[model samples]
Target chain A: MSRTKLDLWVGFFVVIGMGALLFLALKVGNLGGSNFTDTYVVMARFDNIGGLKVRAPVKSAGVVVGRVTNIGFDTSGYRAEVTFALDTRYQFPRDTIATILTSGLLGEQYLGLDPGGEAEMLKGGEVVQITQSAVVLEKLIGQFMFDKAAEAPAN
Target chain B: MNGLLNVVRLLGAMVTEAIWRTGFGARFFILLLRHSGQSLTRVHLTIRELYFSGVLSLLIIVVSGLFVGMVLAMQGYETLQRYGSGDALGVLVALSLTRELGPVVAGLLFASRAGLAVTAEIGLMKTTEQLDAMDMMAVNPIARVVAPRFWGGVISMPLLAALFSAMGVFGGWLIGVVLIGVDEGAFWSQMQAAVDFRFDIMNGVVKSVVFGAAVSLIAVFEGYDCTPTAEGLSRAITRTVVTSALAILALDFVLTSLMFRGQS
Candidate 1:
């Protein structure tokens, strides 16, 4: 009896450990375990992705509603194309602005959606027309320096 | 002058002898590895040892994880509040636990609680000639005894680490959201936004597994090599804890670099 009880407890311990591991993997790590919901793919094009990885969150007004499913570069167009696996529950207008954005200073880059004032909802196999590429600090700094230099000669 | 010269000579000989003994321990470890397949055959013993090492150590892992998490949330809130970003408390607590605190702290506790026990148990058996008696009975002590415990430690370390992180995250939630009045939604959502399943949590699991293997190796090696005396047994147990702690910490650094260096 005692041996059986001890074995039961050990089994219970292993179950709890595995449960915790699964929770961490799914909830905390923001991976699987919520894939039952059907999703729609929305494509967007950008000039720069700026360190965005596949599986980055797709947030709408600070609420995560989907994930980045794939990223590919349009070599001929010199643009980056991104595919989003959006939850079917939330529908965006056809002219929604899909912007590649960083959350915090030195943090991850994600896709932030801003709904536009359009009556027609986005359909499957359609592309989001408006896209704002990732902001490169170096480019902004270079532009600012060039502007200042251009003004210095005049002043 | 001659006496002082003799003292220096004695120190040099002691260092060389210590080095030689360590080499012997390394050889013993290789032999143990060669015979570790016996652990699979001794499944009953492995489960029994796992009960003692892993299940028995769960309480400490959970309690310590809770306290560490609470402290992390409290500290994180204070710091983030200074920057007016207290809503990011979940991200802070989760990142710290999953990356640094969870595996490292749980590993240290496992070393003290289970690793030391394994060492003392084995060392005492050696001192009392039980291991030799087993040998006389035509049983290989390393295969029959040590391998099960070694495998037990290796398996338990990662599980304990995961439990610690989970409990710690809950503790942080309790303190940050319930007691401290942080927005509960923001806490979890921020964490979900910031932490990556592959990057942060997976690397933490890998860290725990490596620490487990290294610490278990030390525990078995020290117990197997102790001088057969009461004092020697005690010293071996102490060395097991100390060496496991040091090895876990050092391995954490090397593993962290190798895991995260590519992302940056």
Candidate 2:
């Protein structure tokens, strides 16, 4: 009887421990990083999204304050439009410029917002008119190769 | 022409005998099922066996699972960090534990510990004429001895697999967050978002059930056919462990291939 009781207790503890661990993992990993609520939406148009995926961080003055929620193409504009969820607390002026910036030399792409001094704040669903597209690495590489070839011939 | 005729005759005889044995085995299975109604009365006996086998084996399983999880997480973190994608650790641990390590490791451990004991016990009964005595008393030995054990193992293996998976994931979390200073919240949430209960838990349980059936059948079959001697019993036990472990691994590979053939 004692052995049976002990067995049951052990089984109970194992189940409880597992359940707790699963709960903690879900709560921490998913909810902590990105707080989508209390955030407004803004749209930016680009020729290419590049390596920018959904949930890519959006930064303002080097601080992450939002994330990219959706990326689609505008048939009329013939441009890729990225929808961003921005914190409502940070009011973006109408003249703010949104640029796709790389975090490092070989890092993920993020949307960086430059707030311009303006009295009117951009509201939800408003498009940020001043948008800088992602830097095309292929074009940069082609230019570098061309410059190298020209310099080598001259030398 | 004469040599070819002899070979053809031998092949025909072998096929005939094989078919006859298969039919006999099928009939034996049906008879065992008919007698399986007695299993309801033997539930207590099965539970007792489970307590001794599964519950008693918890410490070893937990310790091993914890270490395996920790090692996996540490290695996974290092590799992911190299690619600057350390955030994907949760997915890595969850997927590995659920799909691969959980059932295979638990099955191997169970085969080593419980499989040997079961084989030896049944082998001893066969050698001691205890099985013959049961038959004389109008008791079907397979139904009474083998079926209860088979059912018990079938039930216990899944529970053990679940326990192993849970412990392993916790171990990974401990290594990732407490020891390695990963963002505790991020690691956990990523694991949750990545692992679905259907894909992880269900997959593990299905593998465990198949492993349980294979282990129990192989162990019981080996024991039942053992030579009536002490040395034979020892050999039977050794064979049981080896065969069950191998069967578990082979079945795991087959199941994994079938399950994930088109998915990835």
Candidate 3:
């Protein structure tokens, strides 16, 4: 084969290979949508964070506004301390409630923010006082069974 | 009692031979690295080998990847639909291809095709006394012949693996969304949301690079160290494929453990 021809083929191979990598990064993976312009960290404490993992979406009104960055156990409060980075464009008042909610019957858990009527806007490093824990199915079922037994005796 | 003693002697000799060959392979690798400057200086040589090794193997890599991805979608959906999360077929296919199958399968194929060719080519050159002629003329055959092929295999491997993964994801999309009536929005969104670029994709690239280095080194060393006979050349080629395959799988396990341990 001619030198130029071989070079052309090799060049084509390299280009296609690189194109495949680019496609995997942008299309197959989440490289495009993950870029946030500016962000601030907000901490919320939950009594329980069942199956809540790091990098889960933090959504408000069913739209993702941030990502859960860190999850740790607060040693003093005996609660799950969840930290998330919210886009600067979206802000909530000091009374916003952070609730742990599941997507579907069996889907990933996310943090949902419901803003309350408050004049003060929350800033970075401030902890949201009102938070809801992830509801455990076993606990809910146990409570339901206990209530049923108690009512049966009364009946 | 005599038979048992002979068996013990044979076992000891095999162990010693294995250790000696391993040491020789390591030294050959170091020597190849030292002489590798010429392979880069004359870029055309490496590019030529790249054309032979990488471009030639593209067809098998792409077709196999597509079939693998389609099969993964079929199998993944059979189980996922039972749980009513059939939309997750995209995630399952993408994760498996990018994490495990992409590098492993591509590496194995590259070993069988390009690795065997490299071993045979150099073995033939040796059997023909061409290497001896080069040495008599004060020319280093390792630099002129071996290093380019070595670098070519090393460079082509990761690129081929990446292409395989991309083709696989395309295949999964074709089956899941185009053919089987999966939700288009949910399929892509779930895949993108689940497959992290840094954690999954880069780790795969790392795995391919390691596999490439191992397979390339094994191929070149076997070629360089073969006994320079027809039978010796046949054994060298056989050893190249078998060793490369085993090395790829074993190194993959080790790399996966180190890279993804406790990640879940």
Q: Among these predicted structures, which one has the highest TM-score?
A: 3
lDDT of 1 at B131: 97
lDDT of 3 by residue, B83-163 (tens): 888998889999999999999999999999899999998898999999889988998999988999999998999999999
Off by over 4 Å in 2: A1-155, B1-32
Candidate 1 lDDT tens digits, B1-264: 999999999999999988997898788778888888878875777888889889999999999999999999998999999988899999999999999899999999999999999998889889899999999999999998888898899889889999999999999999999999999999998898678787789899999998988888888888888999988988999889889999998999999998776443
Ranking by TM-score: 3, 1, 2
The candidate with the higher DockQ, 2 or 3, is: 3
Candidate 1 chain B lowest-lDDT run of ten: B255-264
| Model 2: per-residue Cα lDDT over B118-155, one tens digit each | 78878999999999999899988987886676666666
Every candidate's DockQ is: 0.43, 0.12, 0.64
- Highest lDDT model number: 3
Better model by DockQ: candidate 1 vs candidate 3: 3
Which ranking of candidates, highest DockQ first?
Answer: 3, 1, 2
C-alpha lDDT (0 to 100) for residue A130 of candidate 1:
96
Residue B11 of candidate 1: its Cα lDDT? 100
Q: Share of real interface contacts recovered by each model? A: 0.68, 0.15, 0.80
Model 3 stretches astray by more than 4 angstroms: A1-3, A35-47, A68-98, A113-131
